[model samples]
Target: MSGGAQADTAGRHGFTPRARLGLTLIAGGAVANIYYNQPLLGLLVGEFGERAALWVPTASLVGYGLGILGLVPLGDTLSRRSLIIGQTLGLAVALLAAALSPNLACLALSSLVIGILASAAQQAVPFAAELAPDATRGSVVGQVMTGLLTGILLARTASGLVGAQYGWRAVFFAAAVVALGMTGIAAATLPKIPQTRPLRYRALMLSILHLVRSQPVLRRSSLSQGLLFASFNAFWATLALLVEAPPFNLTAAGAGMFGVIGVAGAFVAPLSGRFTDRRGPRPMVVAGALFVVAAFAVLWAGGAWSLIAVGLGVLLIDIGLNAALIANQTRVYALVPSARGRINTVLFTVMFVFGAFGAFAGSQAFLMAGWSGVCAVGILLAGAGFLVNVLEPRGA
Candidate 1:
């Protein structure tokens, strides 16, 4: 193995068990910040009205989009620990601002700030890439991503239950407290890694354009992952509508139970990583796309079977999404070991942008076509992703 590959493998594989657990916790805490608003959207709507609630979530997403563009690239230029710590502190204050807001506008503005600062989680992924060995990059990324997905899935359930019991304000307060605690842990535990020489901000921004123009794998992987994430977001965004209406009218608590079903994907993520290590990312990418397509088919088959079908579909969607994500990161990290942060900024900027679009499109789809419309759009997106995989260079 080359020196860079050797460093990656040693960094990933050589961690003590305690250190690994700490990294996992950091990943979970950082990612949970982004997802905390998801299940609380309905409550926000009740307090602020539907239009305001709809825009509030978008505010956070818009902030997140900007973070990917502006904040994440700092990983290449500054100390990782300082960047993570500063961002975490900023996020905590933003969450507290959201918690204390007296009106929808105040809350919405805070959400944007929180989302922008929450790019700390994005930085962690590339940090993990830097720490892992080339041979086992997929496995390392998979393990970390397991924590990430757990944070996302469990945050929905936790926020909904907490908001129902305590109130929405309490949800942000608790999140703020957790964020503070995690920031301390990160400062004490995260290892110091070498920083890249400083580049002009404008020059760093231009590098992404160069990456887009030069890298085939980055292009294909980013597009395919973006579409898959859009499809996944489309389902979750509209799920409440499905459960609240028609034959099965589940309460918020009951609807949150589906998040538990989706946790199965976290378990499946490691297998996908192992597959990526052995056979490379392409076969796994193709299989993941197919699994998502299958999920749409199952959801399309309505009835009592529809409930079981949708549950299975959620599992498949989570698995497929995580598999492709880890594989893509593994590949991209290899291509630009020195620029993992910049590469991830480009990758996640696209993913989150599509995710925001998916959420909006799903709502529109639900408003227009209902469950059938949602499923149709998902099928189309999955099919498009599969075609992208087919067109990818064979050896890559």
Candidate 2:
């Protein structure tokens, strides 16, 4: 089926404010599962010791990347409502397992399942796209993404506070409860949309490549976001470690305080979306990347000397990344309206694969070169993204 026909089949049914809020909640709640471990790494290190703790965050993120590649494509073939609900339920189960884990190995394994099921967030993003009017689509996407980003930052704060007060396992238990509650909300509120044209499962998978080959905007937007995401992940993956070490000497809970500061930046997503609706996404992409470059400069200069500077850098980084993300997503969703699910899958899969790399690189960079090294890596990645934004064909 052509993208246009598929979009036409998805008849517009007044996406009211209530539905938008519901989608924001669902997306936020689902994506939060994949990030709950970042700030808790220090606590995990205390509980399981460093050797085992070091790999837990990476394991969950790698699992999320795998899920995006493997399960998200199914959105184009399956019932999205059923798929989203099933994944949310699975996430609750995984979180419960993590909460009850007897050892780091068990918890790490459970984290992987948590990550895989968390691809439910991917389905929700495109589903929101399908429901909105064409004129306001970018704004709707931005609002949904705002929820997703807010969830990510809040997960850290919740985990840090919960882990500090009740122990690391309590964080997972809390997450499990949240997931179960979100499942009920999703089941009650989400509308049923009929499936698109049925292709054989193998053919459905291969069409991802066909979409990539045919769409220049998807390729450029995906690559641009991937590079910027690498930098974003690089900072976040090591944030707990950096703050927990020498001059800062903060606990796991303390590391999580930064997440609260990051939340302030998330307000930009909706605004960026509105702006993109008026100004176009490319300009925002360029401006956002420049913000990231400035953020890294702050980190490099203030790594050891000023907590205030580092905090400002964190805020800037979040603002920059969220802006670029909203812009890129706006571009991709417009490219092939009917294929939003597949387009999001391809875009995010590429972005998160690089995210996994960024996480790995952040850890290694911290071990070898310290905070200065980490900032350097972030600067290079964001700079590369800016160059791509400038050089890519404007028509694309």
Candidate 3:
């Protein structure tokens, strides 16, 4: 059944199959907005000059981080259905603005707005958690995330293809059309959920800090994910540079194809969720960290010399991160039901900050020592994550 047919009763009866699918689609589509500019940077630079390459993608990413911190909290304060539909409508305008931009300033500003609205995707996540039955919540989150991760992994490739054929403007123009369709779909599919917490905006923001102090699981989960993200970003920040030089001699497109290799990780997410449901999130978290640690080991062992080793390491690291993410998120959401939105805010904010540090650290490491430096960075971060899981106080 389509979402329009199901929306009327979905809230009372809980989420429907089509509604879940809608959430997954919304998550993917909305998040894809923040990434569309990456592959179009070359084209942007051609028209707007070198600064476009630096500022365009940077503006979008910064906007996404800010949106997560600012807009995502509204999920707990407002009707999520209304919020999503409104954001999609706004995203449409932003994308259009991007497509028609005559100067870098206008384009950068539009990109910022696009990134801010893109947090609509993150809203779909906790919404899934809110509606899901406890037994299957992990599985649901995993499935939705599979869509999200795929959109992220594929956005660059899609943008490259569109930009190469039709021009960079066409990519944003097409995205605008998609956003309008998403707006309509959201109105049809999203259940009209009443606000659970009635706190004002200021109070709502402050309460996130309160939740942080109050929930140990939230702290640990956020920290573990942060550490793991540091590892994930370390690999990604340096992958293109590593492969494009000497021994590997891969072109940019070839390096980009590694993103496709990471898709295997997304497919494993649902299985991780199922396992977390049965065995509890803790073991999965531990196992995830271990997998990452082992991935770094494989990379350190031979990844620099052998493309096969690098490919295998990519698969393991992605699987580890996604698996840990599903488990960590499941545990965090289960913690204060009324505060899941704020909890998510804290989680993602920490992860983003740590990811930035990882990128910086990995770059420095690669410059100083080469591939081994990158591998060491991954090991240290993943190992720290493993330690966090193991050293938990045994029932806090």
Candidate 4:
């Protein structure tokens, strides 16, 4: 069946299959920038020293937090098409800078900007929510999120292969090209929908805080998702390091192939969304958190000894994390139809901030205590997420 057949359009303003495909691609491509450095971290350290390598991943995630806080909310205040185009163009520039960087400092700075502009992915998300009717909103979000999540999981593989063949520099140049193409694609495919509201910048930013304070469901969803995201990032941030130096030593590309395997989890989006539409988001969110805790336990118990365990852990974590995210997003988007953009900003800003910390902690843990330390980090974070969901207020 046509992907369009699933989401019944409401009127002239309803979403089209063409737009859905474009947003999916754009979301995938735009977000991939922040993750490109992961598989290349060893190469980066070889040139820039261990201290310098830490900033590479941490800076990208931190910049993503900044971007989500500063730019994504503008979805309610500016044309999403314009915002996407501007961010994509800027992302292209950032990639070029990373490619041309002469020092670790330069590369890290460029990575930060890449992270900031990658919020374009978040823009594509809320834009999807905006155009989708209530009935099929979960389904459409699920489909579009498939692209975003796939881009994220696949980025490591793409960078690992390109970095292995040409060099890390080549990966950034190729990413720059992708960003440039995405700009053109955004121009051609995205509709010029008007802004939802025109609040001043300060008020717009403040509104996010208000939503966080006022909405119990929003708080629980964002915090729970944030903790899970931290666990997910911790695993990715250290996976290359772990595999590169072990009894089962592997090359960069070998380390990255796990991402392809994890694609199994990314494909769950549409199904999870449909499940939410049928059963509600809460049960799905709980199930997802449980999966994460179990994934970490698997990694801790067997990751250091068995490739099968690590692979299984990867599959479980990705499935659990993305499922929770889709359900959490559906919950928030339903809260305020007009403030979808701002609501998303709060969720993602919290999420990426925790992600940044996870990367930092994971790297440090690996340096201090090896694979065991990294697994411990994931377990603690995932446990916290499980607690948050289980302890959610009776009505909240």
Candidate 2: lDDT over CA atoms?
A: 0.84
What TM value does model 1 have? Answer: 0.91
Error of 4 at 269 (Å): 1.2
In the range 331-381, model 1's lDDT, one tens digit per residue, is 787886767788898788788778877878888987998788888888888
What lDDT score is found at residue 245 in candidate 3? 91
Stronger candidate by lDDT (1 vs 2): 2
Alpha carbon deviation, residue 16, candidate 4 (Å): 0.2
Q: What TM value does model 4 have? A: 0.88
Q: Please give each candidate's TM-score.
A: 0.91, 0.90, 0.96, 0.88
Greater lDDT among 2 and 4 belongs to: 4
Q: How many clashes in candidate 1?
A: 3
Q: Give one digit per residue, the lDDT tens place, for model 2 in 60-95.
A: 887887788878778777777788889998899999
How many collisions per candidate?
3, 0, 0, 0
What is candidate 3's lDDT per residue for 234-312, written digit by digit as tens? 9999999888997999999899999999989888889999999998999999999999999999999998888998899
Candidate 1: where are CA atoms >4 Å away?
1-15, 42-51, 303-305, 360-370
Better of 1 and 4 by lDDT: 4
Which candidate tops TM-score? Answer: 3
The superposed Cα distance between candidate 4 and the true structure at residue 290, in angstroms, equals: 1.4
Error of 3 at 178 (Å): 1.1
